[model samples]
Target: MFLTRAPFRALSRQFQQSVRCLCDKKDKDVKTTVWPPENKEKRLEDWKVIDSTELKPPPAENPITRTHRILKDDILRLKKYIPGLDGRTTRQNATMWKHTLFGEGEGFPEEEFFPSHCDIVIIGGGAIGSSIAYYLKERAREGLRVVVLEQDKTYEKASTTLSVGGLRQQFSLEENILMSLYASDFLRNIKHYLGDHVNVNFVPHGYLFLATEEGAEQLTQNSTLQNRLGAKNILLTPKKLKDRFPWLNVNDIALGCFGLEKEGWFDPWSLLMGFKHKAQSLGAEYIDGEAVNFEFEQNEHIQIQGVPSGEYNSTNNLIVKLNTGEVKRITFATCIVAAGAWSGHLAKLLKIGSGPGILSVPLPVEPRKRYVYTIKSQGQNQPLFNSPLTIDPKSTTYFRCDGLGGNFLCGRSPSLEDEPSTENLDVDYSYFDEMIWPHLAHRVPAFENAKVCSAWSGYYEFNTFDENGIVGLHPYYHNIYFATGFSGHGIQQSPAVGRAISEMILHGEFTTLDLSRLGFDRLMVAEPMLEQNIV
Candidate 1:
């Protein structure tokens, strides 16, 4: 049979056309179903007949053609539309998109390095880092200049690239919900700010969290908190859930909260690129360099050497040096660390806001590894174009339909103890089959029949202490600040947190939404705002 890869609407339209043609032919031997010939003709008659040959398999396809034809054409047309980067042929651009789906290609020519500078420096070019860069540039147009330091120009290894890309307002904390709301709004208008050149194919299908008896009480409480914030997602009783999702098996579920709106997954890398492109266009510079250490000067009014603080440093003169065999020096007036997992180490070195700047900075922000497995299942054989994301609280196994028939990407968190080495990102298969599969089978019996086809691993910057985000200025240092330890929800909250961080860096305070709840002071006070929605 033909593999169900084509767009549903398009294929449906084609089938309808053929059916109408066949029905119109002047033949009289007609066989029909429950409805009579007249009823069938009056109904959606065009769908009554389908070509027998269409049921057969499609001819063998090539590994390197067809679908790429349109992609290549678009790349060629959009090249001159974007500036800054040297002219790249369509073939080169095609390879880039291919690398996005598969492995990276041969390295490109290392261009002659240009010595550039900025007033404020941010380390990292992924979601958190790029957001800080963009917001600062937008807010501090007159006096603030920003530079984003990225170790990998493509950000292939960043958690932003490997995220499940889910967004929700079902968080237990008010600030967390508000921050995500800000991001949702920004994402809705992303094309406007980033440009029509960028398009994030965001599907607003909601998420359903099935609460188990073990966690039902806390989850229901969380739902109450979420609902109080005007998020209409209600906690469904087993009966109510059955009424809404009759197709689902809710025998094992206790209380379930379904985010019927304002939640879903999207292409993570696209969102990152959108921000980066706009930031670059607005004069923010993104350079390649991992921040191994920081240079800070201690005094009544402290100043970090490489970073510039418009208040203390010369205007338009920003630079930082990369730690290489040859000392590469770059100086910036101010510095913001958005280096995800590495933020902990960077903060330790600067002695700025360690453990929230005073009482104690016991941030349980540790790097943990997890695996993502995409599998083919006999259960969901049809193209899952409209399935909602289902989270089983009992098993902690999340399931969603694959765009392609008979397949979906699924995985689970590894306990902190058994996780991969913070530095080794290598993928392990046994972890999935042994740890994830048993739990998955318990929640969704349908998944019991699934088999893993492909898998990958990435890092989660776990906020171990309270599993909450840490935002705002570094307590000890003046110009140095941070927005890290978001745990896994970084991408969803990056938009608002980024704007908040940028506003703080430029104007010395929060202008829009108040972010006092996520400040670094939590560590010192020994009071952390914990959220219960962590997966």
Candidate 2:
């Protein structure tokens, strides 16, 4: 059974000093029930449950400023478990977690009868939702509370979890490129403050983009902008790209650029968990409920009540509820709608057309179906695990290794007409045979003869406008904030989006970066940031 090591105690003490991290046990008597089987037989007291806000006493001798690397490494090695882990994804993610500050937990705790409520209510616990919770919790006060309301417990349909999980800076606008650049840095050093428990892997495998004639012109221009902003990894020639990714066929008559070091994918949920665990430890709450509708209390809040009130008068409050015959009232002083595809569906209640209000932009971020197929490699020589995250910008398709034997591959919908209905949540494999396979074959001939592998389908928060996200405040709903319309890039954008949303609510304006450009005012002027790198 896994026992608390010396490093965990040191880490727990560190978190405790930063904020008052409390475990919500009834009687201050913690019980041991659902501890990971790996940690079986150990008593909860022996497990070292330290308050998150508590910190370790400083060492008297050689002073360590922050983020001690070795002790941090040990914290990650201890909390290792994967339920329903697809064989190809388990090891890489866990290993990545060991080095990176990728967050943990499957969105919801598996333990039963959990409570949920907080002063700030965030809808949609995907990347953006959870990220907002992180910032909100990070700046918590004595009694000021924050909570996240998520629909799916397993995140089977979260756009953040389902998307390609890519982050790049090849944007036509300087703001977009710079924001992503800062986000990349934030991702790299997440474990420094969030938790030493996990390293949170953000592999610098690099991003490859191909250019058709028009796309080439766009890439050439954006590459200059990316470079001016210090995105040093931009590639201008096809030869350079071909040399970097030998597997890529760059015969097309245009240009190509790769974010040589600044762009790549990472462990999304671990990032989610890193924020979530720290947030919870610092007194942020998470509720597993589908935020179906809202009550616009004029300038105040949407009410939430029921779901077994907490004895602490402020614990276990579920903000979102299915459309049951009964009505429960839960209120939030400030409410942020980070709901992805479902944001539009929920916003229909107030008829608030997507203008600006954080992640909710005029972006046509509607749900569209996409399929992911898994392909086993030829052998160890062609190991999928070592393969980098590859994208064929020509058709907006990409493939990357899940872990060992197979790769997780997907591409955009053939056309808006071919997209699945918003009501449909089922996986469609036919899209692969009719559209995806042919396009994949053209990009990587190795895949041309590659046999069909098992496939699954999920939704894309299709940004109907330019492929960029819709963030910031709405024109009419000043008090209400929304975080929808990420198109397919929400996961990478979640961390930044979360912090921005929190800053907007508590401080009245974004201090980190001015998100005013992403607001509803843009829609009023009919000016939108059209992203060229949508895949």
Candidate 3:
């Protein structure tokens, strides 16, 4: 009982503090339930009752936002009851609230239901989809009915929520630098775009990328490209790194590139929420369901069977099948495939790109798992004072403050071995101990005794072709535009990519920025737009 009560009260106090920050819910009745017993059956009984009635609204607010908060509350409460398990279990339980929220006896507003049709439908309503919706509606002249289809209503499994939220313009390629530069500007003026009421908590402490002697030339070249694109990057020597960041162990570091101004981390969930709420306010309808299949109209279908040479025409119409057993036949002229890791699978449904010797370019995007660890630094000797996002390029290790004092976030670069089951959202605690901790401790010796509070795994939409984003319309399916295959950098690149896609939809080409280098033509011709700075 002591074990259960202690954690519950602590969590409840933290919850109340956090809730005070949310202005919309401050006036409303939002209940935080706490159970006395540690039994699963008793906890479930209480949870069911609270979830059914606690969120009943009097004062109007965003339903999805309200639901997310409530589910998060329940996750913390339930996590306290489960005993003798690892902290990662709490993270996993917290991530699966969609299963409980949208289950029996829980439902959303009628307007929030999966619509039958719309003017524009964007799949995968994560950060990218939401951003596109926001931009499209912001620039729309004729009130275009934009709809976003997201399978995870709570966004518990989405990479946007799980990401470390580091934004930087330091890149080996010119296109990446330009995209990140646009993102930096957008993030700075985010309030003007996302409304004054919302705050994303952008921390521009800057990013420090440390490279060994072997990687110094490429790092220098990257810094040059970044500088050419108007980015404020300073090449720091080992002594400079030590002076700037006293806690850094720069013994093996040959050279470091630091973004002085617009490179840092932020609250990813807040940015996503801002985009979602703004898009919703601008009349973009968001649906909750998985996109299972695609239906192409006969006019849109190709005559590969009859002709000696299978010449492609265009897709007259597309029908998207939802997991909830609803089929939507789109009468709209355009559909944006921004499904991230699932984009390749979605493209396969249209039969645009599949096997060998096909004229159409294959979106070689696949899910690669990456782990994020949350740790609390205890000792006085290990003080991380206002540290920027520090990365060891050779070791593929990175760490930064988690906004909460004494707590820090860290992760290691995903190698080829990390590529496993796409459905696996479970964290590998062993990986932190075996792979991550060793390298991180070597880089920052203080991390040797750091306590891992919690951890979770996220999937990157890794593009095997170039490891860069694939944007623009498909050559075969002109109606279908792509904003997917951003690999791991989707959250930081969402603003620029979203704006570019919106421009393409509104003005028929990229007006604001020329994103042609990330087009489908590059993928088709096997021209890889390589981005060497990947972490």
RMSD of each: 22.5, 13.9, 15.3
Sorted by lDDT (best first), the order is 3, 1, 2
Write candidate 1's Cα lDDT for 34-152 as tens digits: 22222221111121222212222234334234234434543553443233354766676556544432224542322223223346778778898888877766665434456677866
Judged by whole-model lDDT over C-alpha atoms, candidate 3 comes out at 0.72
* TM-score for predicted model 2 compared with the true structure: 0.70
Which of the two candidates, 2 or 3, achieves a greater lDDT against the reference? 3
Model 3 spans > 4 angstroms off: 1-115, 141-143, 300-328, 355-360
lDDT (tens digit, per residue) of candidate 3 on 1-535: 0011123333453344335335433223322233343322211112111122223324665655754665576565554336334344654544433322323232222332333335688988889999999899888723466878786768777889988888999888887888889988888888899877667788888888999999999899989878888899899999998887777788989999988988998888988888887786656777765554454434424544332344444442344444454444443457899988778777876666753344345678877788899987665446464788888777678888887578888887667766545556878888888877888777777777888999988888888887889898877665788898888899999999999999988898888789999998887677888778888
The candidate scoring highest on lDDT is: 3
List model 2 lDDT by residue over 340-371, tens digit each. 87665555544455322332333355566677
Error of 2 at 209 (Å): 0.7
* Model 1, global lDDT: 0.64
Model 2 residue 379 CA deviation in Å: 11
